[model samples]
Target: MSDSTDNTTFDSEDLNFDDFQLEDFKYEAPFQPAPEVQRDLSFFKSIPVTVTLEVASKEIALGDLMKAGEGTVIELDKLNGEPLDVKVNGSLMGHAEVVVVNEKYGLRLVDVLDSALTGVGH
Candidate 1:
């Protein structure tokens, strides 16, 4: 390479924000919808994501937690037959119910979270 200096360096002070607008800086999805009115979200389809079904949560005293054993029973906030919260990558995705298929425990989707709430596309 010649003795030319590189201008690729990034400096926050070098940016001009005089014409910037909050709307112009809003986030947008990387993909677009299909022509058939379907969402073409195959961009990150192959990426693995962690899914968790939250049954319930309860806050117990430290003494009670320390005294818990194999036979110990703890109460949760949710009642029996209540729907469980389905989380994707630690974000609330939807609500589901426990189901048994092929002798395997699974979750049956009950309701999907709204796109607006999940920030799925907007």
Candidate 2:
């Protein structure tokens, strides 16, 4: 057999396929599932996953980063009042907004990710 992009040529007379056999095959044993394999998925349900909420990020020079003080402020790439990204296990799951819940800061979900079809959190 040859590919379309190949430039090499072969001599058909040098090939010999007359000695091939088809009836000599035999099965040694029947196929079976392993003893440790189980249909239950209880073990996967107990696993822990990390959930994270991102606010903003910025990159600055090393010299500028070294001159930081208690009153110093570094500007981020994201603007204020933008929706925050909610990630699960390092993947983007959805977006949310900051809310006040009984004097405590909380995240109110604005969108939920659907990963059933594409298998991607984003």
Candidate 3:
């Protein structure tokens, strides 16, 4: 058997954290501006994108389509001078007007559809 006595000593006043100072260790951060990061957008630009210019569409029956041949005139639903729908990878990206450049058909962008708000490009 041993003597059951509380002989541990502890003084709250002896423990002082106010005498600590960080000046004992010399530390100086080098005067260096952040490195300029050049973003390379060539990868995104190199990606193949399909741009479609929607002119018009017409729903015709299978029997009527078979009956039509060369010299047959089919009418579309879109009116003349109407803005054409521009689609990118099957997504509606914007609207454009048809133009002729160097005897080639070209499209002039008129309105750009917001992909973030409209969730167009997915």
- Where model 2 places Cα greater than 4 Å from the true spot, the runs are 1-43, 114-122
Q: Which candidate's TM-score is highest?
A: 1
lDDT for model 1 comes to 0.85
Could you tell me the C-alpha RMSD of candidate 1 in Å? 15.9
Q: Count the clashes in each prediction.
A: 0, 0, 0
User: Residues 15-35, candidate 3, lDDT per residue (tens digit)?
Assistant: 787777867879889899989
Candidate 2 residue lDDT tens string, 1-122: 65668577789987677665646867578888679744665566667888788998888998998999899999998888989998889898888998999998889989877854244222
lDDT value, residue 58 of candidate 3 = 96
lDDT of each residue in 1-122, candidate 1, tens digit only? 78988779899998887867867677878897667765766665667889999999999899989999998889899989989999988888898999999999999999998854445332
Residue 1's C-alpha lDDT in candidate 3? 70
| Top-down lDDT ranking | 3, 1, 2
Per-model TM against the reference? 0.59, 0.56, 0.57
